[model samples]
Target: MAAVPLQEWERGDKTNVEIIGYGWRVLEYFHAEEKRVMVRLHLPADRDKDRIQLAVMLMLRDIKHSRKWLCEFCGAPARETHTFNFFYRVLDSDLPRLVVYCHFVCDMDKRHVREGLTATHHLMNTRFDGTLGPMPPFASFGKRPSGKVYPLAGSCAGCQHEDTAVDEGVLKRCARCKMTRVCGAACQRADWGRHKVACGMIYSVTFENWG
Candidate 1:
């Protein structure tokens, strides 16, 4: 299994510490380093906690390699699977930022329930409070029953349209930020004045050019 960075453990981010705490006892068997805090895994006796430890290790190993959608709790790969994608309200004015985690392990532990519709449904519909109630009638996972998904595509910073280079080949991604997509040269030129500041910030972070 991969090893987590000591720096990350030292940082003591609440979420990070919670995940590490989950499997810390099992992890200690593999690494002999002393730690400031430790918590035992609460899996059934037959179920090994090594898998959880490995998942956490892999997550820390890849944190700086570009993919940021990995499980926020256990560090498992989250994107192409049955992930629980929701938001925790962090700011008063801003829309909730997306948090994704593997449905089977991370979400189950947080809800303190075994695998079932009760856990999955709660993850999709409700907020992050630790409550286990019946699944609401209107709750549906993936694209909804109406076959519509919100934020259909990346909005063009130039035209403010729900289209992007991935969905529309005509659009080209911004050369600097690589986040903004524009319909054409005309749109890119029109948006340049307003986008420059954000573009510089994004470029600096992406390339690790900050000094």
Candidate 2:
């Protein structure tokens, strides 16, 4: 995580925090008591960061709806008192933000997630909250995403079939992300449901940056 400079701000002051992986900004103020000010931002994308953000949003919503806290990642009892409000979609007038308490262990090295997602053309973010309760009913959080394992350079994203495998010479790459590879059309089709979101978002990024 990029170090959030706070030399200018007084403690207990409300601030705005931008959730962009590449920058730092204030967002919301989670009160000393459990304000549980979880945010709901309507957005779309399919990179690792996007995937991870989606995962977290569902979790926060689960916590808010349940009115309790559990460790979002490790399923441990989490009572740490630290919070962050990450707002990703800035173009919109209503920037949704959430400030939830998270464990130091779970919240450490967030920058790694951002950089790793960028390098792999994947996307994700991790900010853990120690909200303990029954395991969330995941079905309510929309379709569970398929496994997003990063395949080898020449392996099939669907079946993990390698280029050297019989009848699998020269894997066909997804033109959208230019990153995902598969053994053939069969494997490509198998992976479509999983790859489509990331593929579209990545290509959109490239399109936006065409200069």
Candidate 3:
């Protein structure tokens, strides 16, 4: 579904905006100060609908706490909860905003640690009262690899060869994406034609200001 513009929402007519077949309903609408408009969306009980809701929430400038529990990192249902404090830079403001993560362990799993910033943890005294049991182990959210057994290396993007630590500088990451690993300059040069598009897309979205 296409995203509705702010002008359409400001029209103050519920029928002016179309969301009939989009599996979402407008529960409430309010105009706040500072030219901010609040629209409460009621999403259906579907996975895709939930994802749409999450995307909408992320675009909002000022978000308040809700009763729905979601993992800040993975967007899954939160079982064990903790609070994390981090500064998030937005387009509207020069100063970064202090944001709190409901699931602090998920934040750690993403490896978002900066050079000088250290994250302080505060455990929330909340427990899941639903029928669901303890949270399952996620592949992306787990203890850090020792690098002794796994070595924390990726396969060569060009040759598709499994990177092994034969020397200290065996595999070097691509300067742009930093995700693709190349065995040597020759492999990187060979892969440039095919890898450039994907690399640019990933790097722009992840690192650069493409918002």
Candidate 4:
């Protein structure tokens, strides 16, 4: 999804490019114009946040990048992205963290916040409602994005061991959540304290085939 934009950013007349994808968070340091593009995202009144202030934007030139976005609903290439501010913050500013995107299929609602300097729902009308409520923590996106390429196998949560040496092919999934796997009862015991918190949050997604 970001391929064309990267190409445009590198070869087109503009020195910088801007987009708004709805599902991911926003990264500050884009331009003030991009900052203003936030109002249209229709994010829930309360989005999650965190404390770490990221500095990757300042070093954009030195960083190797490979982020390409897709439409959450249609799975098509996306151009513009949406906005939402998760946990990160500065002293007194609202720095949006996640992002959502839209293609030409949607129409801009033609709205702005605070003298067109900030963004609000830029586009909303589409064949179907593409708006998302709020982004979840990066941990719960379900079966990591690379799960297909690298399906996770049972590893001892306690000692982080990976071999079974037997024919059972890894230990059974944790009984409660049916997601976590451990090498044996003892390892599960050692890791129980840490895994409990995450186990409660690991409910499967509604879509069976989703990653």
Highest-TM-score candidate: 4
Expressed as tens digits, the lDDT of each residue in 101-190 for candidate 3 is 322122333443211012222111132132123333345344545542221213455564433323334567677655455677997899
Against the reference, the lDDT scores of all candidates come to 0.35, 0.33, 0.32, 0.30
> Using lDDT as the measure, what is the rank order of every candidate, best first?
1, 2, 3, 4
RMSD of each: 16.3, 16.5, 17.2, 19.4
Off by over 4 Å in 1: 1-121, 124-152, 161-168, 203-211
Q: Write the per-residue lDDT of candidate 4 for residues 19-82, one digit (tens) a residue.
A: 2323223344572211111111112223322211121121110010112222333333222222
| TM-score list, all predictions | 0.28, 0.28, 0.25, 0.29
* Model 4 segments more than 4 A misplaced: 1-46, 51-153, 165-169, 205-211
Candidate 2 local distance difference test against the native: 0.33
Residue pairs clashing in model 3 are none
Instruction: Report RMSD for candidate 1.
Output: 16.3
Q: Once superposed on the true structure, which residue ranges of model 2 sit more than 4 Å away at CA?
A: 1-52, 55-154, 162-169, 204-211
lDDT of 1 by residue, 7-59 (tens): 42232222221222111012344653311112111222222235334433333
The better candidate by lDDT, 1 or 4, is: 1
